[model samples]
Target: MKTIAGILFIVLGILTAYQSKQAQPAAIDYAKERVQILQLIDTESKAFWDKDYEKWASCWAQEPYIRTMGWWKAGGVTVVKGWEERGPRTKQHMEQHPKPNPQNVRRENINIRILQDAAWVTFDQYGKDNGEPVMDMPGLSRETRFLEKHKGKWKIVYVGWLLEGEGN
Candidate 1:
């Protein structure tokens, strides 16, 4: 009798542990999605530096909210359906700019944080403005981005660029 009871308890413990682990798919998915968002940002940085506005912007969701560096100009996500929404704007922006992009910049050392319905990301970006290599940005002009999962896809809702000791 004692041996049977011990075996039952052990089996129950194992089952509980297995159930908990199996229930973590959402968490794992959230983490993966967060990484993909950051990767998109990285790709966009390349697009800007390389003068590929379309490619740079392509990383965003259909209608993504963007907070470019300086000047708080807000943009809407017109690419709601699919490629049709993006192809035109991307082509136009690239045509107007015409290669040899001004940014030609690179982002360094990025970190991301995932929350229930939002996320925070920080990275170092250095580039040139009008043929002058812009430098000396300390190491913490981090940008925090707010993200929301829409229809099973993550999109940026808001973003703010700031440094330590700045705001709340």
Candidate 2:
């Protein structure tokens, strides 16, 4: 009788554990996360076109903590571990290369994916840079960005771009 009671208690514990696991919520809802990330992208794009650095900076994770990387076809890759290091450099560069014709900018074939607290997006971008159509210069380029949810916001942590076509 004692052995049978012990076995029953063990089985009950196992069943309870399984039931609790089943009741736990999923870590991510892809659809919801996708929408949030898309909104973030739109806001960031608008900020860039408007030359709103403060708003643009808000879309990125705070630096000195987040691992970050920026890549360009010409420069290859620049690894900046913290936002503290990247933010000022980015601001200075943009200040020098003002976006005179942001309306002509285009982002095509945008795709986004979310995995838990992380997300990534890829797209083909082409536009006027330095007052000339990029298509006339470097042409269309592919861009990929990695983002993470921080402080209830999705912030970009890494961005990479590759100039399309050969000899670029």
Candidate 3:
């Protein structure tokens, strides 16, 4: 009787452990998530360059804490905080500069790290126009983007970049 009871206790312990493990969340599909993130980033850039304000706004979070900042040799530093401020300013800029400034930019040395609902991405970007390097804009820039997954979609929360050289 003692032997049977000891074996049953061990079996019960194993079953309990197995049940607990099964209840844990499944692993994240990082490859799929990375693709989704890259798509969103590309969409945002396209919308901006196309001067499509509505599409551009869709890529960003409408939260108050959202921000966009950049630093360049000519412009020094610029920080735009809050979606309310950023959104309106962007719309106005697009309206003022309605011409589509199409970009043939190459992004390289990209790195992305995802942590549950948040992600951080960094890349070096080179701009080109008419089969030649862009002269009026920064030729290369180091860019960083912060995104958050909300309601099963990723949205940009922060963007910061540093241009490699002065603007023309």
lDDT of each structure? 0.53, 0.70, 0.84
Question: If the candidates were sorted by their TM-score against the true structure, best first, what order would they fall in?
Answer: 3, 2, 1
Any runs in candidate 2 off by more than 4 Å, and if so which?
1-27, 65-79, 97-104, 130-138, 165-168
lDDT of 3 by residue, 1-168 (tens): 999999999999999999999888777799999999999999998888788999999999999999988887666788999999999988987787777878867899999999778999999888654322222234788899999988989999999988884341
For model 1 the TM-score comes to 0.47
lDDT of 2 by residue, 134-159 (tens): 21214476778889888767898776
lDDT winner: 3
Every model's TM-score:
0.47, 0.67, 0.79
Prediction 3 global C-alpha lDDT: 0.84
Angstrom error of the Cα, residue 163, model 1: value is 10
Sorted by lDDT, highest first, which candidate order results? 3, 2, 1
Error of 3 at 70 (Å): 1.0
Candidate 1: where is the Cα deviation over 4 Å?
A: 1-25, 29-31, 62-94, 102-109, 129-142, 162-168
TM for candidate 2 is 0.67
Candidate 1: the clashing residue pairs are: 49-104, 63-77
Comparing 2 and 3 by TM-score, which wins?
3
